[model samples]
Target: MHDPSLIKVGSCYYGFSTGFEGGPGNGSITIRKTCDTTITTGWTYVGTIWNSVPAWITTRLGSTPPNIWAPDINYFNGQYYLYYGASIWGTNTATMGLATATNIEGPWTDQGEVTNVNYPIDPNVVWGPNNIPYITWGSWTGNGINMHVLDAATGKLSTTDNNLWHIGNGLENSTITSNNGYYYLLGSRGNCCSGVNSTYYTVVGRSTSITGPYLDENGVDLNSGGGTTILTGAGPEVAGGGADIFDDGSVKRLAYHYYDANNAGSETLNVRTLFFGNSARTGAADWINVSAPIYTPITGGTVTVSSSIENFGWLKSTVNDGQESSVSGAMGWSSSNSLTTNHTEWVQLDMGTNKSFSQVKLFPRTDGANKGYGFPIDFTIQLSTDGTNWTTVTTKTATPLPSGAQVYNFSATTARYVKINGTNLRTNPNDQNAYRMQFAEIETSGMNSGNLAVLKPVTASSSYEGSDWFTHRVNDGQKNAVYGSKGWSSNSSLTTNHTESIAIDTGAVQSISKVDLYPRNDSATQLGYGFPIDFTIKVSSDNVNWTTVVTRSAYALPGNSVQSFSFTSQSARYVKITGTNLRSNPNDNNAYRMQLAEIEIY
Candidate 1:
């Protein structure tokens, strides 16, 4: 939720998009200043750069099971260019293709192929220190990744084809990043898209020089088995796989995909935040997911807010300044070299001095040009302490045109810095709510009364695997798994018939709440059971003898479904599920994957 008075910023919104079905991999395009942490504004979706069948990407490649994989973006020759792959499903034949637009949202022109590697998958382009163009990409057909120099302007492969390194028998989805004199190459191994049965995870390797040998933590050759695993799957429904390496100025984060037992990679997106340690290269870093990104409101000082816009792929969308109709002239927004005609541009206010102001206002020079869409403006606002660190306050919206100055307020209590972001412009004539640009003056003042709080879990527990697996069910979806996906299928539970129960480490306890129970469900055609299955739910403060929370007998469970039940308990540390009986479905390995989603202790 965005506070109208405050500008909300941060790439966390990518999670919202990630969770969306058919969401692309470029994640979020950001025009961030170095120090902005709460990341209040200035980000947008350029286009679905990675997904092969992204609705809009249909012009070149026809929609089929396996088409486009991942897309990598970089700016060159005064234009924003997108390089993507067109690989044949379950086969190599991967070709790197190019598209360029004067703006992020584009009327992109397919520039042709960049690589002809047998399995030329996962293509990444970089401009070296001397301004020479270089390309790096990996293959799924073999253990090696190949690198070569390219025409700085044309992207044609140079004469040299140096084997950067090789790792594992086959590596999928490889990423390359450069920082502080070191080049980092990251990749994920094992099967991806297995739904609940996926064995996907991530690993990383780095090199000091742009060329040659990259090594993992123990100094193993990534060309062979040299990279170290940075992340592994945990809890129920194996997680991990498909990792992208990105830096938001302040920290480097590995944004990847995972299937929570509840949605199984259906509705929500999950990411692992990686922090760079003293070593500086990209390897040897601890990663974890703590809910989502954090935002701290600005308080007592006035500071200028500015940004460097990079089209995060989703371009050629609707972007309007303020004009009521498409006939009305609206100024096109652009990066120093944006490709789309009505491309989205980033704007910032030089607050002059560092003073905390509650509200900031932008006066439009005209009713301006409005995209045909009803409410044309879709942008975010952010605040910064020093011109560097910024935090997003909230997202703001506006009609085609406002009389004088349009006021988009935010509730964020940020101090001493302010910046507004303009993004998500719809360019194609058929698109809607496109954004344009116009500016007058910005006003700032006072703070609001709310202090920030943490998002606490409403339910809690841990599961352990044991002989003769157990199945526990949580049926009441309301109080047990608060603020979750719709339909009963959104609940998380753990069902195992183990003599030993799973142990959940509470770290620390807050207050109290209820527990829910439900039978686990899987989509494998191999398992057959109807609606309603019998199961028992148990709770334990310590992983010892447990007390039954709830139980049912000979109940039929909905096919591939989730249900919940609730109970009162103190700040307990562990929870268990034991399978007393099985429905008509045959007992198969992992017939019951744990459904535990969240634990709440108030």
Candidate 2:
């Protein structure tokens, strides 16, 4: 949305922005709501305020423009008034329109034109000194900024003492807020709508009188094209403008849209705390700082260790449960390698679905008894979409001191699985110097899309048909479970390889991008023992005429992990995994069968 406006109602916040090409306001005003208590993320679109372009606007312009201009919303005199424009870009022949409703969620009725004089465009309402509310608007096209007394009763221009008074200039959008004893005029200067090449930035000027001359920090009049630069951004986010302030009964929040070069120059909404401490709050200082963005805590997922010493409170889940410090007792993941013989160990985190991440951190056991006793002697950090095809992100040839957390940073990538493979283990001095792999916590993060198939309809050619290894377990989003909830397994009767197949229906035809298969993780000795050795992945629109997208032979075991298979996009309603050569579990007395703990479809 261009020139977005923000407002808070109770615990809720709403954003109204200009429509896109095929959206409601090239047809009407688009509305969206906040996701959580947090300012923004996964915003819920609340439909357009109106269906078609207002008849008065189309009649004034003679034809509908491909898109609409900036808009503002306010609550005044026990009603909500929405101000919009009937104008095209780079033209002086424009008018600002008004719509008012009893409530925010409204059947807003158009109250005709608010200003058709002197190239009026971006319109906003700012209440000033006495009990008067003033409407302000301006663009670089004509006089910078203009304010007129707004009659709260009719939500229009006042009949007495109202004039098109000039204030500040530069570009569209005049967001005025009265702080202490001064009125501040905020505007965006320079060209916009050019994406990365756009040079637009925000500027500010202040004035003691509500309608008189506004001056920048350098004492230059805004009417003379002078304003102090406040927010000059850089790429990834190149241009920032169309700013508004929202007070939530506490601090004031500044909201705007910045063009992101990394995402094909798409404009994205941004909000930050406008910190004006005591001095800045009193106008003694002119500069204000916008706090850095805050990130949400980890969207945790089920964790699986190749072989953990769960007998001692060293469950795999402890590794990511925020208990790395000395506050807790002996906790975190520790391998079951009690013998002196060295063996490679691994731990993996299944984020439930595909995610985009960059950094992975591992915290060593902080207990005084074993500060860094089992820190990996040599290790590699690997990532995968499906647990099968692994890409080594970084390698530690030599072990580092177990003084604190080990940090690994790399270029951002999207995946579903993260694995820390300890190739060589450090010897525990307290346990007869036995080689081991230990860590208090491991944190790897990123955002998520989600799985399309979790508990969807599934069928299998042969299932264990027991309470434990039922066929539905493959799509239950579980990686760690006891034998009772352990995953799908072929029946004893069909013990031969290539005798097992499972199919999932996604409820509707979707563009299939990837599929993941997870190995059973409950049994330490049987982990990764029954994974399918050879398999074929097939997609079908009708579940009859199937197309094979991938075929694998000599696929390595997951070591009790997931294997992700990403291929060319395929339109399908059903996905099938057919095992050609099943794994024989030596731990299960050479049981020839197929088994998988979970499946993820993306």
Candidate 3:
């Protein structure tokens, strides 16, 4: 069995799986139904939806008993649509067909081939924000991961040509879901069907629009080969793929199959909680896997370095002295001062005060085209408070670095000065003759400090017309001063005086230090429209017990800018911002509302 797709209707859940048996009805799509909402047990085989390969499919693909694979079932407009792929394995001559049923256990009607683009497989459908139904399907040889708007009634392509969205080299099984104004594309990469040797894992990318140039957290476009790994087989699980995401009211869960390492790598159903967190580099949210119900923020605050306390400021073997300024890329570090050498080198940073740190991040030189060129192949980290006495913390050997920052987590240790010594420095991976020891930045994370509210579920008292403007937008990581399309706005034309508030649930209690609010500035005529005049920020552990962190009454906010309010760190799981007195739009007398581009909590 392969490529299982899941759907829930009423009290029962239905799953469609891929199979190929060699007869008239043998290769048809298989189905299983269960009443267990938890989806851990009680699955009853209900048999295949199609009795045999449809005549139309066989004629189009020039094959009989076409191997039907990767079936997806979705209910829309009071009808169940089953989309399946019909093709020969490892070939580009394939077609995706649709079947409709009035019930889950159906006497179905075949809708014939939707498209015959490059061995189209893995048919998945999702409704966009505009309520238009879009279908995504493709395989390795064809236009990888093609998408097209569908004629809702006919389940056929709305356009003449299939639109190629992402080129997943040998990767397929594409699925999509939307949350917090972003559409995430999840796909399986690597060999699948090889049992214990299967290299299949799940990769994900996201875009603000349904049809998009989806990008990973590193800002690499999916079309240009970029996706963040979300789940891979580990320990007892050898491989994981064929993923499907479902929102079960309270929280979202990912349902997929993993090859069990202990059980001869048999594919078995596994489920896990999924989350999205803020990405500082892209100013957008990215998916994260969580073990517990509570989420851990991926990005966090780093320890402040007061100054460098190095034994040798420059590389002794180099002709020009390598400056200590290269050790820190904080404001004034010049590119010319980047420490460079081919021999052993060491740099230490004084953090000004003794602090407990759990993680250290090293950023290699990314200037010009020398990305990940001078990173160390062997390195060790040490900690010292008095600068004279040092304790070796961790050592890494012969690790080839990628073109991005690498992070290492360690047992919590206290130190005012941190030192890193490098030997066996890497020459350029592309150019073996080029050899130098250089780095852009070294950062450390202090204990109990990070963005607390990233990707948490948010709710608001009200929305302006309840259209695109929503409360969740405030925390969606889109902070554009001129593009009002991505922020939250309170109701328009408010005749009665009332307060509007938006609240976020952090999933677990966390210490928060500050909140930054960006007021709306999307319109030229209404540059400061909907800026809150008087507001109060509050935190709460239990929703019933609230503690006011900051309160401003009759205060005017600056337009097109971020206003930050800080207070002593407080612990809470929920944070709320309430506008008691909203500023009236200068252009509209009746419109007294509050709009915010983003809300950052740390």
**TM-score to true structure, per model:** 0.41, 0.51, 0.50
Question: Which one wins by TM-score: 2 or 3?
Answer: 2
- Model 3 segments more than 4 A misplaced: 20-25, 159-170, 279-602
Each candidate: what lDDT?
Answer: 0.45, 0.76, 0.69
Model 1 lDDT tens row, 158-204: 65544443433356666666665666777767766567677766667
User: Per-prediction count of colliding residue pairs?
Assistant: 143, 10, 0
The regions of model 2 sitting more than 4 angstroms off are 277-289, 293-602
Residue-by-residue lDDT tens digits, candidate 3, 214-312 = 777777877777888777655466678887776555456677776777657777766555666554234354455433212111232232221222223
**Top candidate (lDDT):** 2
lDDT of 2 at 426: 84
Candidate 1 residue-wise lDDT at 45: 35
Model 2 clash pairs are 24-28, 25-28, 144-169, 145-168, 386-563, 386-564, 387-562, 387-563, 387-564, 388-563
Best-matching candidate per TM-score: 2
Model 2 per-residue lDDT tens digits across residues 1-602? 67888788777777888776667645577888863444655467887777777777878877776666677889877878888766776566788889888877787888989888767777888887788889888788877788899887898889896677888866567788766577777888887889999988887788888896988877788888877766675676677888887775555667778898766899987766554321222223533444433222244667888898875767777888877653354478888875658889999988866665666888888777778778898899998888999989879977865799876666555677899999988887777888878888888744333565666667898887685887766766676546556878877533555568999987567568789888887767877866788899999989899999989989887775578898877889899999888888777767778888888887
> C-alpha displacement of 15 in model 1, angstroms?
11
- The TM-score, computed over Cα atoms with residue i paired to residue i, of candidate 3 is 0.50
Assess the local accuracy of residue 595 in candidate 3 as a C-alpha lDDT between 0 and 100: 79
